[model samples]
Target: MASDPNTAPHLFDRALLRARMDRARRAGPVAFLLDRVVEDMADRLQAVTRGFSDVAEIGSPGELLPWPLADRFASITRVDLDESETLPLEPESLDLALSALALQFVNDLPGVLTQIRRALRPDGLLLAAMVGGDTLTELRQSFAAAEAECEGGVSPRVAPFADLRDIGGLLQRAGLALPVTDVDRVVVRYDSAFALMADLRRMGATNILIERRRIPTRRATMLRMAQIYAERFADPDGRIRATFDIIWLSGWAPHDSQPKPLRPGSAKSSLEAAVKRAPK
Candidate 1:
């Protein structure tokens, strides 16, 4: 059955609740991956400064902290849309900003990025990680197969994600400079679809597509979906793999730069010299 467009908000609420349940039930592996990324980020930040006097973490949900640096910083504040429509910080006051696995959920990403840029002091850095478009390929395929077998058609139900290629441009549009983005694909194998759904809940990553059906998903349909997922996507080892593409981004808040004329007595390097100087 096709989703009711009029019930977009209701569907989103239901999907959010389902995601919360999934996170509560299966959080171990997901937390493990999240922690590694946070630690890596924290280590880099620590190298730059002995401590930050003021820092804000957006959409953290009380998790994904690098606790080793907890004592190093003079103050740490957590910000979430659930708490406030606007960021709690004064404009251009934050020393650093960080987020992980959260940007994908925001409805107005550019607006949020603009807010982050506004909250940062000139040259302050923003680092964020979010799930990219290629996540959950196996689960999506299974869902499509189940719809085909039971309903004769599959209406789109998944939330769309930002592409890596376009992320840098978004940063530039938000008035952030020196943007960098990289993709990390993590493949996790599951013995059963039920277990996979459990993990998604624990990670607070249940689907919240605006056009999702409001009616309860029937047990029969769920089972059919699981079976189709296992049969079509399971590996020879009898486990199904879910691929999560995590995109990491870093950028500096905008700053004025003084342009200089070309050097009076310098010449461009030869193509051969440039090729030799590039990293092997």
Candidate 2:
């Protein structure tokens, strides 16, 4: 069950999460998924926005994009949470900021977005993608059932994900302009739930809740979760499926140049008149 929105404490252990990422960076196939999202972000940036002199890519994997497209920026700074501080970005120093699959783990996401807004110059853009929505539903459900049956209780096994509307609200609350949010759901087929869990481990996406049980999960619970997952989510071919919802968000630092919604009731035509005039 989810915690109260008003009273939920920061549950993630940042130190442990960083350690998981360091280990996952060694061998993570999930990087391919992020690579695709990066390509999409790059295309959108190049196609819609002006060329920026200073750009930063937070959480860049081992290699920077090796292509002319990346050279369009006069300078690009790659930052990783493990390598440097994730907060206190120099105020108004960046013209463009990119984050791929990194913001979800933040304990204070709204504050972080506000910081990003502060770090961006007028009209500077923040384009990012994070795991959200229904991500890991099968695993979460399976874990809950297995733990409830075996241990008489359930612990947090998956991180809670925000939906598109909530993220849009956050962007607006951060004083961003032209905020937009969308989602893409991707399902991957696996031989069993164990394979999916292994991939999550390799991706450094495992549970790292501070309130998580200190003792290791029981072996019986693990096996039961696997069985429940297969029984509930397997296809006709007997291969289980895992769901990942990627939420993409874009917002610009508040600037007068950006388009604004027209004032309420400013339209020349009345809504009732327009409806009556329409073909019936």
Candidate 3:
């Protein structure tokens, strides 16, 4: 089914985004942020389990989930952003579906997630990460201030990121079993705000907001923004701080054999009695 146009805002230009990513790939390692995201995702995936018979990794680019996960899955199929948006998998065919630093751009996030749930075999798993939760607060603030000071207004520069509470709720709404979500926060240091922007460009993560300003930004305004960024977020060494929060979510497709939480009032021992039995 197509996404509801009334409620869903087209906030991103996805074709342009793909072009940006292609350019970034040609440039190579413009930003190390996604690399870190993929690395952490690999660790998380490894910690939970290993060795799946059939797996699909969606929306991961270049290096495709790091080298460590190569032999763990018997087969790994890669799907880009467009495929993930339209989830073209056979129902109940996949043993595992994984994505990294993606899915935040989808116009219909809930619908996409539900489709992913449907694609998984019963008891199959979905482990994914998206850049979110104050990921670029410093840059957002800097750009807003610069735009307001230079043009007396600010246009949308950073796409709004999803929150953990809403994300967990979405997992449940998608009918995922035993859903879990966690936020991983990391602070990276850059020599300057300009350097940070350069990296964002290389990452193909620069502003692709549909409502972004059409004209080029003024150099003087950009300089002022850089100054403000340094004054507000610079560290002891004068390097500016950038925050990236990778929200990780995982769930299993429902099956009769999987463990289920005890029903309310079905606990064998009471909390009060357990407390009483504890040593001082």
Best by TM-score, which number? 2
- Give residue 49's lDDT in candidate 1 (0 to 100): 52
Q: Write the per-residue lDDT of candidate 2 for residues 1-280, one digit (tens) a residue.
A: 1123345357678789878877887774467667677677767776874767788777644344566777778888886654223454788999998888888887767767777788899989998889999999999999999999999999988999989999999998888899999997889999988888888888888988888788899999999999999899999999999999999999999888888898998989999999999999
All-Cα superposition RMSD per candidate = 6.1, 3.7, 2.4
Ranking by TM-score: 2, 3, 1
Show how many residue pairs clash in every candidate, following the order shown: 5, 0, 0
lDDT of 3 by residue, 1-280 (tens): 3345456677788787888888888887564666777777777777865357788887766655557666777888887667236777888988899987778877678877888888889999999888888989999999899889988988888889998998998999888999999999989899999898888888889888888888988898889899999999999889999998889999999999889999999999999999999999
lDDT of 2: 0.82
Off by over 4 Å in 1: 1-30, 46-51, 83-85, 256-280
> Ranking by lDDT, best first?
3, 2, 1
RMSD of 2: 3.7
Give lDDT: candidate 2, residue 174: 89
The per-model lDDT (C-alpha) reads 0.74, 0.82, 0.83
**Deviation of model 2 at 265, angstroms:** 3.3
lDDT, candidate 3, residue 279? 100
Q: By the TM-score metric, which is better: model 1 or model 3? A: 3
For residues 68-127, write the lDDT of model 1, one tens digit per residue: 776666777888754123456688888788888777776556767888888888778888
lDDT measured at residue 241 in model 3 versus the true structure, 0 to 100: 98
